[model samples]
Each structure stands twice: as structure tokens, then as C-alpha cells.
Target: MQAFEAFMDDLERVIRSAGDSGRGVLVGGDFNTRSPTWDPAVSNRRGELLERWAASCGVSLHNDGCTATCVRAQGSSVVDLTWSTPSLTPTVQQWRVLTERETLSDHLYITYEIRGPRRVKSGDGGGHARWNWRKFNAECFRESLDTCLAWGPTGEDQTTLAGLAAWVERTMTQACDAAAPRARTKSSNQEPRRLTRDRRAASGPHHDIEAEYRASKRRLRDSIKAAKAKAWEDLVGSVESNPWGIPYKLVLGRLRTASRGLTENLDSETLGRLLTALFPRGEGSVPVSQEDRSWNEG
Candidate 1:
């Protein structure tokens, strides 16, 4: 216990450094601690200490009410856990257990998705140029480009071909500069992308709906969070005293899913790859086979 406290103190030091630096934090693994906040089935001394540590650090536990992280003949345990700071909680769009995939360990696989600013493309950011087309005066631009096209020098034979080429390029570039092209998105002073969409697209009479829409969306997310916690609690209660109930529920879930259409509209190449296991590869085709199709299946 003394050694565990030392280790926890060291870990907290790193977490504190991350918070002070304003860097997002994500720490996840088999914690081997059980808490009512995360699993609801049980709570232990170490789990209580862990909660206190997180609260002191202003980090949120993300594995709330998640169960069956480790399953055995006797029962399932929510030993696997994930933790993130306040700066990171909003960025985690989804977090759940991967029940479809089973490992040699009693522990199940877990996954979480982070939704935030994508890294800027490296190596000169090669893509089509973006201009302030929304505010552009198209008529004036057309006249300017047309004048550039008409005014090329037929009399520049006095200069070298290279000089004439440079002159034309300079003229066109100046015109384009005057046209006010931009390379990045316009910054918004308030609200988010979705809220901005709601506000901007609102008509005069329907403007009141914008605020209501925002509130409704917030409520929906909160409701989902609460409902998931309750659902997991119910599941744990049902299976706690009956180990056989776990497999029964698993079989029923499989049956329900099997009744639904499993195949989606797939492009030819993707469809071929998806069906490769059931269908032999055609002659001359590259022998590429994916044993684990769980990449996007979840």
C-alpha cells in the first residue's frame, strides 16, 4: 500500500504538469480498481482513492457504468478503465467496450474516439486554393481577368521570351491578389460549427428556434449519458447473481442483430474484400485477405 501510494504520487505529478501546460490528457489501461461510478456493481478502497485523485486533478472518469471489461465463469469485472482531463472530455466523441472481439485474457477490448481539430496536412499543405468566394464580387473579377487576357503584349518581341513570360505572370498575380483569396477557414468569434449553422440558417420568423434547438441538443446528450449509466446498472444487477444470464443475453443480442441486414452499399473493391472470406479470390487477383474485419465494423 505504501508503494502504491508512491506510484500514484508520481503519476499525479505528470498529470499536474499536463494540466498546467494546458495539454489534453488520456490515460487508459486495466486499472484493477472497481468503483460504483464506473462499474456500479462494486466499489473498493483503491477505487475510492482513485476517484479522489482524479477529482483533485480535475480529470473526469470516462468509463462510467461500463461493465464486463473482464469476464470470467464466476462474474464479470470492470477492471479496464479510461481517464481524461476536463480539456479532453469534450473531445471524446465515443467510448465503449468492444464485445465482438474476445481476447485470451478475460479482459475485453475498449475503444474511444477523439473528435477535435485535425492536424494540418504536412509537406506544403497541398490542396486546392480556397478564396473568400462568399464575399467576392464576381462581376468585377470577371472584368479584371478578361482585361488580363486581352492585354497580353504582342509588341514584347523587343524583350526576351522569358522576360515577356515573367511580365504576364506578374500582371496575373497582381490581379489575383486584388481579388482577395484566402487559404484557411474564416474564424468565428462565438458559438461552434453546428450552432453557427443553426443560427445562420434561421429565417427571421423562425429565429427563436435556434436557441431552442441548441438547448434540445444539450438535453439529448445529457439524457443519453444518464440512460447509459442506468442501463449498465440494470445489466450488472441482472447478471451479478446468475453467471448463466450473461451468455443468454449475449445469444439474444446476436439473434437480434442477425435479423437485421448486415451488408451495406459497398463499392466493388471493398465489397470484394469484405466477401473474400466466404468467396475464393478470382485468378490473377492479389492474394490480400483481412482476417480481422473489426477495423470499421464497430
Candidate 2:
């Protein structure tokens, strides 16, 4: 019993390590011992060790195979049992004992119904299948102007057209004003006066301001490009990870074919409008000011 207990401890350690390695494990065998606490007649010292080991490893000794009395042979009690990690407890939907002859061993064959993680299916749909853009794009000021010019003849119609034209112009001006960058205020009316040659020599020559500005712009552009690339890579990785269990290359082919057919039927301007509506500019606007304070202030 002492030797058996030592062996069970080593076995439990191995099982625990295997389970901790992120893999599902099923460790089942005849340990030739029954819990003395449960059934005094058949229980032994080895049963105590097994129970302790099972508790430490969070293992469940499923009683689907053997009966309590089966520990003593002859009448043939259900002594065979199965054990598994705690994480796999929910997956054990059902357990059954098979015929002894089927297993070719003294113990009956135990079958486990394991429920693994579900696979994603591509057919799952219903979210926005198509997007629209133009609806959210600024109204066409140029188109409005053209419409006003085309309208003619009646004085009443002309007056209405002129009024619309004035409104469109104001809207266009406002849009331009919003898009333009704010002007920097001048620090002083006159530039700092140069000191005498010896005094001025103390300060180094003025830095190449234009060159630095150009370099900074280049760095910003590179950073933007790199960020965009990284974002695209991450998107691709996410799609690959949860692939919906469908061939992506085949889906891409189908999408391309469908797009080709759509290109002929859909107007370029209308498609652009749809895309604009799908991802409208200024959709996530930041507060222009907080308490009328500059953006730099908290």
C-alpha cells in the first residue's frame, strides 16, 4: 500500500503538469485500491493517497465504471474509473462502460463524450452586408451652383435659385473655414536686432529651420504609413485566427467576381456616396473646447 501510494503521487504530479501545459488530458487506470472512507471493508491506505493526490490536482474520479463493492472481485464490482482535469469536467457529457471482450483487458472499456470548442461558421450573417457613403458627404456645392445656373425663364424661379445659390456659397465658405488650419499669432512687430559681430559670435548660426521642418514631415508620413500597415496586418491576423471555417482565398475570389459584376451595375459616384455614409467624416468628433479653454489646456 505504501509503495502504491508513492507511485500514485508521482503519477498525479505528471498528470498535473500535462494539464497545466494547456492540453486536455484523461488519466485512467486500475490503481487496485478503493476509498476506505467510503467503504471500510474494501478501503486501504492507497485510497487515502489517491484521494489526497486527486484533491491537490483538482482531478475528479468519475464513478461511471465501478460500484463500491466491485473493489473485492468475484461478484465483479465496477472498480474501473476515469479521471480528468477540472477544465474538462464540463466536457464530459456522458460516460459509459463497454464490454470486457471489446477492450481485450480485465477492465471494462470507458467511453467519454467530450465537448470541444465550437468552430466558427461563415454562413453566420445578418450584420451590415453593404455600406453607403454619399449620404453623409457634404452636399455638392458645385452641383447646387450648376442647378442654379441651369434654372431660367420665370422670375419667381430665378429669385428662388439666387437665394439657394447664396445659401450654398455660405455653406461652402463655412466648410472651407472649418477645414483651414488656425493662424499663428505674431510674437513681436519687429524681429530681434542683431548684436555686434563679437557679441553675435557667442550664439551659434541659426538652425536650418526649413530642413528640420521637411525632415519632421517625412518622419510623420513614415510613421503614418507604418501605422496603417500594422493595422492592416492585425486585421488580417484577426481574420485568420477566427476564420469562420471557410477557405479565405476562395471567398476572396468570389468577392472579386461579385465586385466585377457590381462594377458594371453600380454607379461610381453612388458607390462612393455609400462608402462615405458607411464611414462618415467627423463621425467621432473630439470636443472643440472645454469651458472655452485652448485644446492644450486640461
Candidate 3:
């Protein structure tokens, strides 16, 4: 349609502007169009035109492969999709369509796996070398002594005196050895503070890990609550009993507690396994409950 074409042109302009402003663009919605260019069987002149426009703007369309045929004539189409710029493509590691049975919508829902950027270590560079008296000969030392004497007796004078004493001691030690060679020592002043490098020691690792683990568990609990809310909405649509909802919430809570315990103990493998078991993909499979004997046995 002419209106749809105009709307898409406006959207592309907005996306281009956003990309110019350094924000990665990701657009997803039911565009209500499909084309043979994208899928041989699907036919829509508007979709083909839109796809061309998207390609021109350096956008790639992500199709989840859900079609009306796949849903057994459920009137669902794979028109729901996503498009993103090149910069955002790397962050989207995986994208797939979830099951359609859980919700009232005929079209299958989608999920994306996005990975964050890697962290780099700080404070790795060439620094100033340690100071040594070997670089100064007898004449240089005499000149330094004269310079120190010229300063009036005060805090600055005392500081200069300390430096001169250290220089004399170093030169004497160097002269005492028959085969003494110039060597460099790492300066104590250059070392980073212990607290900065190892923050867990100042704040006990156990306490920090426990606090973070608790926060993570709380977040997971909230996600489970959100899932339950979705389930409740579905139940209301179907006019079904809410008996199973409470058990789902309880299981999610228990899983969160278990995950928190595992993370605090630094058992990453166990935590990963727990997560996989909780979100297992299959037909008629419920989330693993804390009361399950198998979970405890593992």
C-alpha cells in the first residue's frame, strides 16, 4: 500500500538517524507483509519493496521460520520478524521462535540470546624506571650536595637532606662490590594499592558473593513471578483453575534459592545445570522443583 510504503520510509529515516547518533538499531514487529524474495511461496509486493528498502539501509531481516503451514492451519504467519543494523548483529548470538501453545496468540513468540562485550584488564603499560645513584658520578654528587646546601633550612631542606643521604648510601654500596653491575629494582611507589587490586579481602569474599548471589536470586525470582503472571493471564483467557500457578511460583522460588546457594559456593557447573534443568525445552515438561529428589541428588 502507498500508506505502508510512506510509513516504512519514515521508519528507515528514523533508524538511520539513530545509527548516526551511535545507538544500535533493532526493529521488530508484525509488518503484515511477506514476499517471495524472502520466502518463495509467500507473496506480497509491499514486503518485497520494504525488504529492498531495508537492505539499502544496511539492515538485515531475521526470520524465525514460523508459518501458517507449520502451525497446522492455525492462521499463524511468519510475518512477525526483526531487523537490525550491522553493529547490533554481533550482539544477537541466537534468535528463535518459542512455542505457540502457551499463549492465545496464533503466531509463535520469539526469544533472543544477546551477549555482552568482554572486559579488558586495566593498568598494563610501561611506567617510569626506579631511581638509582649509579647514574650519578662523584662530580654529579658534589653538584647535588651544593644544590641541597643552597636551600634554606626548612621542610624542603630536610627532604633534600634525606635524598642526599640515600644517594650517598647507594653509591657507597655500589663501590664496595668488585664486580657490582647496574641493576634496576621495581619501585615500591609504583605498586597499586592492595585494596584496589583485591577488593574482596577488605570486604570478605563470602559476604560479597553472598550479597551478589542474593541479588541474582531475587532477580530470577522476579522473572519467575513475571512468567507466572503470564500464565495467570493465559488461565484467565481459558477460564481454567489457578491451582497449578501457586506450585509454579513455589518451584521458581526454590530454584532461585538453590541457584543462589550454588553461586555463593562458586559451583558454576552446578548453577549452570540447575538453570538448564529449570528451563528445559520439551512437551509437557514442568520446571524442576526444589522438592524433587533428583534435584537434591544431583
TM-score of each: 0.40, 0.35, 0.39
Instruction: Give the winner by TM-score: 2 or 3.
Output: 3
Candidate 1 residues 200-221, lDDT tens each? 7875657777778989999999
Q: State the local distance difference test value for candidate 3.
A: 0.58
Q: What ordering of candidates by TM-score runs from best to worst? A: 1, 3, 2
Each candidate's lDDT (Cα)? 0.66, 0.53, 0.58
lDDT of 2 at 54: 71
The candidate with the higher TM-score, 1 or 3, is: 1
Question: Best candidate per lDDT, number?
Answer: 1
**Regions more than 4 Å wrong, model 3:** 37-40, 64-76, 124-298
For model 1, the local distance difference test gives 0.66
- lDDT comparison, 1 vs 2, better candidate: 1
Query: What is the model-wide C-alpha lDDT for candidate 2?
Result: 0.53
Tell me the lDDT of model 1 at 58: 59
lDDT of 2 by residue, 55-107 (tens): 66666555643333232245454445677664454355567665533544456
When sorted by lDDT, best at the front, the candidate numbers are: 1, 3, 2
Report model 1's TM-score to 2 decimal places: 0.40
